[model samples]
Target chain A: MTTLLPRAGARPPGRGPRTAARRRERLTALGMVSPAVLLLLVFFVIPVVLAFALAFTSARLISPTPAHFVGLRNFTLLFQDPVFFRSLLNTAVFAAVVVPVQAGLALALALLVNTKVGGTNFFRTVYFVPVVTSMVVISIVWMFLYQKTGLVNHLIDTFSLGHLHGPDWLNDPSTALPAIIFMSVWQGVGFHMVIWLSGLQTIPADLHEAAAIDGADRWARFRHVTWPGLRATRTFVLITITIDALRLFTQVNVMTQGGPLDSTTTVVYQAVHTGYDQQQTAYASAISLVFFVLVLAVSLVQRFLTREKD
Target chain B: MATTPTPAPGPRRRTLRRIPGHLLRSALALLFVFPVVFMLISSFKPDQQIFADLGSIKAFLPVGQLSLDNYTAVFDRVPAGRFLLNSIVISAVTVVLGIVVNSLAAFALSRMRWPGRRLLLVLIIATLIVPFETFALPLVWWVNKLPWLELNGFHLALTEGWLDTYRVQILPFVANAFSVFLFHQYFQSIPKELDEAARMDGASWFGIYRRIVMPLSGPAVATVAILTFLPMWNSYLWPLMVVQDENLRPVMVGIQYFFQLNVSWGQIMAYSTMITVPVLALFLAFQRSFINSIASSGVKG
Candidate 1:
């Protein structure tokens, strides 16, 4: 797309006496670009700076009284809050469970459907149904499905010959977060499967044929070639799953609302809870700052762990 | 993993080996789709029938008395039509604006030389790392204090706060970093010589972007559109915070309204099905582009 040679009808290579056309190019480019740049500045950059600044203030969501700087107050209170701790723990537990399980399962599903067989499209489409469906709908549907006498429990009981009884999935403290996690993975895995399938396509057929000719077995070919070939996709799947798991607000918001004694509380959910519902803007800002750092730290750690190790 | 796209004609029994794999995949696919299948089927049934059918595989089948009663009742119980309209307006506006704005910005960044182009590209990409949730809370407060101009008593008035409006939902999501990046990557595939050739003909830069570059970038546009539309249409958390007016609420937030009042399960399924089916239809229609767009997000970004 680029060339080192001088462009045809190129302007003279001098700083002085720039052409009117050249001047217009700069203006045109800026004019074209400024709308997006301005919007990002207002919506993204300013809010990020505000997140940091508002953390140390006592601002309310909508208040008549002006906010003043409150040094370490929000952080101190956040450290003491059991709900905050639970949210943090729940977030970590989710990312840890989801990153491996989702990524591995997606890769397997991708492999299963990557065959050049008939009905491959059908299988791919079915696997991706959840990805296409919105999370809110999925959550609501699963809310019914996860009931003690819902379809899931009914299936379990039938499979176990009527000996097993299921508890309320969203109501019980122990099962609430896990239930959400299960549904989240079920909704999201198809997406990663698509990514893996694409990655699989990119691995040239000759490489696999050559490996097979060299007497590699099924698992050996996968372990050596397919797995290694998916390094970039693997990194992507892991990082995305982790980030999404950390930013687990919508499902919890829809299904649990951080309920069952705050057992399903997530960092993002807690931020919204205090920020909007509780109208404690400053406190939420502090939580947001910490969350931003946690995401940053986890991403860097992932990068370090997954970096080229040759 | 067979390397061949098509299997060879061999011993007749060789094809039988694939049956087990096919069966496994079909079972896995069934597990993936059954819940949505159940939802779609359950939407047509009454509550008592729904509960009765739940104990058997009939829960996922429309075997019982099926009718449009739940759909009709959904309208009476809540403003399902209004919420769907609001979501369509918001998501459609945001996606259209996002494609146009991000592509233009990407064109400028990729095609033209400018003083701060490199720095600007870097800056835009940097914003992608900060997930929206991190700034969502502050963004609520920030948008509230922001000003809007509206016609008041036959004259334009400076109004404070963008809370409870369509623009609040649309504008913030329009200038997406990922969309701009996708456009940039896609534009790079188009030959720069086309731009130079068009410019040599006394065409304006915007003319090149419009007449030449953009028309050739249909794939990029589709990818950006799908990616943009999904999140905007599925947007829940932001609207929950910023939008308080019922009329301004999108479907995701509207679903919450229906979720409350202890509604019947049949009605909830009906509402869920109503909101979801259109998107699912779009997915089926544009499955290739949708899959590619998602894959590009993973592979490139």
Candidate 2:
């Protein structure tokens, strides 16, 4: 709602030559923006409208015949279908777990590197290496490590924790989603850490100095000063992570293919599966519309929660 | 205890306190770095040795029975060279076009005074919330019907569709909302006096952008370029949906080609290494700018 609100007019009153100059400026602006506007209209705006329209129809991708509208049927079917509900639940659980865990770990890492330590840049770079690597590549690498006789289990055995045998990570339904979550957190924490680091740097040094002068310990300083400063950044990280978690597809696609019993099936993955693999275009469109609504709702809630107090 | 004067801690005590923090940080950093390292090292080792070395830290070490055999096998199994070339071309073109188009739009919104600019910006920013997954199917259908100019055996011919081509992979992504927003933000920070001065000297709007604004926006350009290149390089879902031709498939789609029944671990590692090395190199080279951009934009890589 805030982003959608129009700003009050700021143009100054003028006449004659100024009006002509203003027209020229407007024309120039139009010329500059037309390419991007046109592209967005074609690719984003129109497609979104079409997606909404398609969700109401019984459309099949491969069918030659024209499709007919089936009002509320797709949504009704989605609600009734156990697999659809399972996917929704899986995505919800994934977001619930990963968002906080990833954000917390990232904050911790940011605090660690924020200390005036030697070679902090080197560690920052090292942590961010996984972030730059493609998700497909990371998933493939992790798939190898998640094998039964894989490096992960081998390491566990070598470290004298042999009693706690590592389960076949991606293959076992019980551990599959959690395994992917762990890998995702590992890959994503660096990104949030960098965000937190920037937020940490923005906190005025004088505030910390004053807190120390007031006999505050490091823990007290962090709780009172640092946490307050990072409220917005924390909210941003939380929402972004939740959204990213909901869209979990590449890992599931590359590693598990939503299998070992669909433990890792997410909304986006299900949409892709239903639409592309099953050719249930209308149903997939419905699923996507629901997802879009969920995302928008969450973002709105986050914005409301983080809005500045009057 | 209050009456006693405590001696200041020596340098040794300070060093001792720092050692634990440094060690812990290093260990955690190593945890993140190990997978990529393992991928690189495993690519050099043969399949048996990769498994043999798995029990110890040697799994991450580039030692024992090392050869480029897996690399050779990867090339044989998948068209590694073609995939790499395709990805580079797609990513490069997307980055270039994205910079030009998005920056122009941003300049309009941020610099030129015009009616509806605010509304236009809001609309552009609003699109950021709509994830591509939500509308990808519709986009596919639309692009399937879109026109293209194809060079059919050196005779330029009009085509009805944009599918199964590099343009299909690149065009949709070139007009990025986030990039436009980022460039807009960066442009706002530049002083308006510079633009006004250029205009006073009889410079056109395009000339002002080219000579005055773009020249001073190196960091912004770098950030947008890096951000644009990343998604294009790692594009998976779009290409998968639109492209069925193996020749036009990006490196990400080529990854699925290796996911056959007999899972060749070494070859997988080799293929991953090949795809990942360029990204790692790019990050290493633009480490500062990449971090700065992400930090400023609050965008995840």
Looking at model 2 chain B, which ten-residue stretch has the lowest summed lDDT? B1-10
- Candidate 2 root-mean-square deviation in Å: 6.3
For chain B alone, what TM-score does every candidate structure achieve against the true structure?
0.95, 0.91
Residues A11-51, model 1: lDDT tens digits: 54442334567799999999999999999999999999999
Model 1 has fnat of 0.81
lDDT of 1 at B144: 93
Docking class of 1: medium
Give the chain A TM-score for each candidate. 0.93, 0.92
- The structural similarity of chain B in model 1 to the true chain B, as TM-score, is 0.95
User: Tens-digit lDDT track for model 2 on A115-165?
Assistant: 775677888888898888899889888988889898888877767767678
Candidate number of the best lDDT: 1
Candidate 2, residue A255: how far the Cα is off, in Å:
1.0
